[model samples]
Target: MSLTRRKFLSWLGAATVSTTLGQAAQAASNKHFSGYPQSHGVLFDNTRCIGCRKCEEGCNQVNELPGPDRPFNDLAVLDKPRRTTAKAYTVVNRYENDGMLQGPVFRKIQCNHCLEPACASACFVRAFTKTATGAVIYDPSVCVGCRYCMIACPFEIPAYEYDQALVPRIMKCTLCYPRIVKGLLPGCVEACPTEALTFGRRRDLLRTARERISQFPERYIDHIYGENEMGGTSWLYLSGVPYREVGMREDLGITPAPQLTAGALSAVPMVVGLWPVLLTGVYAITQRKEKIVKAEQEQAVAAAREQARAEAQAQLAQALAKAAQEKEAAIAREVKKALEEAAKVPTEQAAAAPPADTAQTPTEEES
Candidate 1:
């Protein structure tokens, strides 16, 4: 009936098991995805672009993207660098070469639509898809607002509609897929007068890029920007200067983003699935250990208490026996002294009787 320390520890251990089990159950219920195959893609040629802001106008008109504070025709915004937003699927930013009088270089910024797109790989709810047309499309219905894709995307292309109160979705360039399906050029490619933005099969674009590089070796950089970066993006780039000068990240290695997490993601289920049984076994072992320790502690305490009690009892017994022996010795000594005193008194009385007789005879003669 006693609430011992061991019982309290066992209850605490059970609580820990319940808490960990709940967490494991929640983890098991979470969603994940492996992407679809045979997805198509596009390639962008930046060297041919002339900083005209024409692609900006084309995207806005085609997608019916919201009108900006400054009209698309206003060329002043191109003076500074700009990123893609919900209202605009793409933007044209100007990067002027230092100490060069040449016209400011224009780069069109949009989703790169990676071959192993990180956004697609990171989406647990399967909201984003890399289609066979080389376009990365998004579905809002399945989005759970986790935003893992935003962190996974190396180019930071996907922008969330945080301002919307309800039904916010990730927005980016869809590569004008409806028009492409209809066997028509994308609006941006159609609108460009100087062939700044090229729209074609990704394979053909690579051939065109190589021919240009070989034709005019001094005009273009030797490397294509997205051909192999992050395991080959569909949206490739050809810059007149270095890609870094135009704000492109060159350091992201050629490995596919999904491959980076394949090992850990594959192991998560096994680890989570086995954790409960493993933890339960460990708990049982630890509980038994605690019980053994508690038994040993209690036995030690009881032994100590019993030893102390026995020592006290032995000391008491010895004291009582010594007292009884001393009392008997004292009683014997008193009895002996009383007998000696009694014997001496009788002798004194006997010695005094002849003196009394002599005294009585002298008194009669004198009378």
Candidate 2:
């Protein structure tokens, strides 16, 4: 899928917000952590598990998860290898161990609840919490449904609720966090009749795993899985054969999940701080370009109007000049007519004066 810029920025922003929200917790996680003091954990002895799926039933019952398609009593489900699902927080898988004359070994799969949980580190909403009780619990209310926790998990324990489209949740084993808090054993540990699942303080669990391995060197492997894997998980394992024989990954090194992803996640804060400024600058530049275009349009219109006004003014000036010239020509013609009429009056009077000379001698005799 194509990662759009807006989506990328949103993820970065969420990461930053998560960091800010959990800054104190994150700061403490950066240091060398050796698990919380007196925190509880579970130890699964693979040699003892009978593939009963009792733990699976207990988990479903205790967590109130949805009923599986196949009932927990059905052993037929163990034939196929299965991972934890949204409906099932834990599942038991049967592995054919060629090293064991017993023919097959059972392995229980669930969230390890790592000491430094990658889920907590990867979450951009601070949805996952590594509580003091050794349970990495999740709060669905705060979850943005990013699902980064699913990817960051070394065991790939987190499951998505695909059925609930409106409000999907990332589901996983909480280690029976509520049960532990109330001084009760986890339902899975209580349900196991063969003593395959052991629950106690994390430190004590490690001691117990070591003792079992040392006591039965011939029957089990010396290495206790999760002792240091992903910087020590709350759930440790003791297997008769190699872990890889049971579909478990042995290559996930001792480094904590948070440290493994710190390099990439560290850049989130920088991006978060700079993204808004970058967007603002882009907006400003866009606005400036728009303003320039608008100004140019206005100037063009103003210039066109000015040119029209100038043309109209020049036309009016020419008309006024023509009218003045016509008025002056008419005045000059009237003056010339007046001068000709004035010159004609002297001639007419001279004609009348010839008769006056004859009448003047008669009037003098009459007087």
Candidate 3:
């Protein structure tokens, strides 16, 4: 059977439409990042924590971080609250809760390793990596000191080395990825003798967290920190008092930090990419308008000049005609005057001379 050209075209159009629709559907369904499955994670139970700096010491020893000004054995370091820094990957800070029965609560602070890790998403150079072992690691070689990761992190974990004259890198918790891959626990978790920090699969940790909360309703807060906060984090937290009292942000919704700027960043390329073209088009239009206006002005000026020249020529011709007429009238008057003078001269000569009869008589008498 022979198909008509129009029918063939119609069938091709339908197939093309179907293919496009299918692609769109697939793109919509597969929304982008699926966080690492069966990833290892840590759960920190604040109720069991004894404000010991063993985890900090363990982190420094394993990561080979520089020695601190105060010795790890010095319990006096916990006197003042401290944030994570280049030298220290982790810190345990004590918060005094007046309302709670427990006088002071100790909470460990480190990189949360968010599911959609903001540092990884923020880095344009791909300096940060979110590994399958639930570790968010930083590569210093690729970092250009943008400080975008520091800004993007909701927890504000990434720190910059300002003192370093050159080759400054962002510093943060690695979640002990090297040890986890080798079937060993993180330094902090290993050092935690009280079992405050439990290392296990992220899914299992979530279950364990729920079980702890269920087992001791009076001892723990109803909600688990990092369970759903910032789209869930590998490092979970359990607090005796409210998370807010302990300096932890509870208001940050479940949405990831990167998602906040995703739409804006996506539109950036469109805006930046088309700016030159739009500006060029505007310039061309302005130039064309200016040329048209100039042409019109030139045409008007030329017309005015031509009109003035024509008027001057007409005036000159009129003056020339008037001068010619005046000259002709003067010549006519001179010719009349000369004719009159010549006539008078002839009359005078005739009068001065003898009459014709007198002359004739004289001639007769002489003969």
Candidate 3: pairs in clash: none
lDDT of 2 by residue, 1-367 (tens): 2368568767777878976564433433546889899899999999999999999988889999878898989999999999998998899999886675477999999999999898998888779899999999999999988888888887989999988878999999999999999999998999999999999999999999899888889888889999999889999999998999988899999988767656665666876888778986998899999999999999999999999999999999999999999889888888888988998899778868797776688889999
Q: Which of the two candidates, 1 or 2, achieves a greater lDDT against the reference?
A: 2
Off by over 4 Å in 3: 1-34, 145-147, 160-168, 316-367
Q: How do the predictions measure up, each by TM-score?
A: 0.69, 0.67, 0.74
Worst 10 residues of 2 by lDDT: 22-31
Candidate 1 Cα outliers beyond 4 Å, as residue runs: 1-40, 99-101, 294-367
User: What's the true lDDT of residue 35 in model 2?
Assistant: 87
Which of the two, 2 or 3, has more TM-score?
3
lDDT of 1: 0.77
The TM-score that candidate 2 achieves is: 0.67
lDDT tens per residue, model 3, 132-201: 8888888988899989888888887898898999978898889988888999889999998799999999
User: Which one wins on lDDT?
Assistant: 2
Task: Indicate the TM-score of model 3.
Answer: 0.74
lDDT tens digits, residue span 312-354, model 1: 9999999988889888888887888888788879777876767
> Which pairs of residues collide in model 2?
none
In terms of TM-score, which candidate is stronger, 1 or 3? 3
Question: lDDT rank, highest first?
Answer: 2, 3, 1
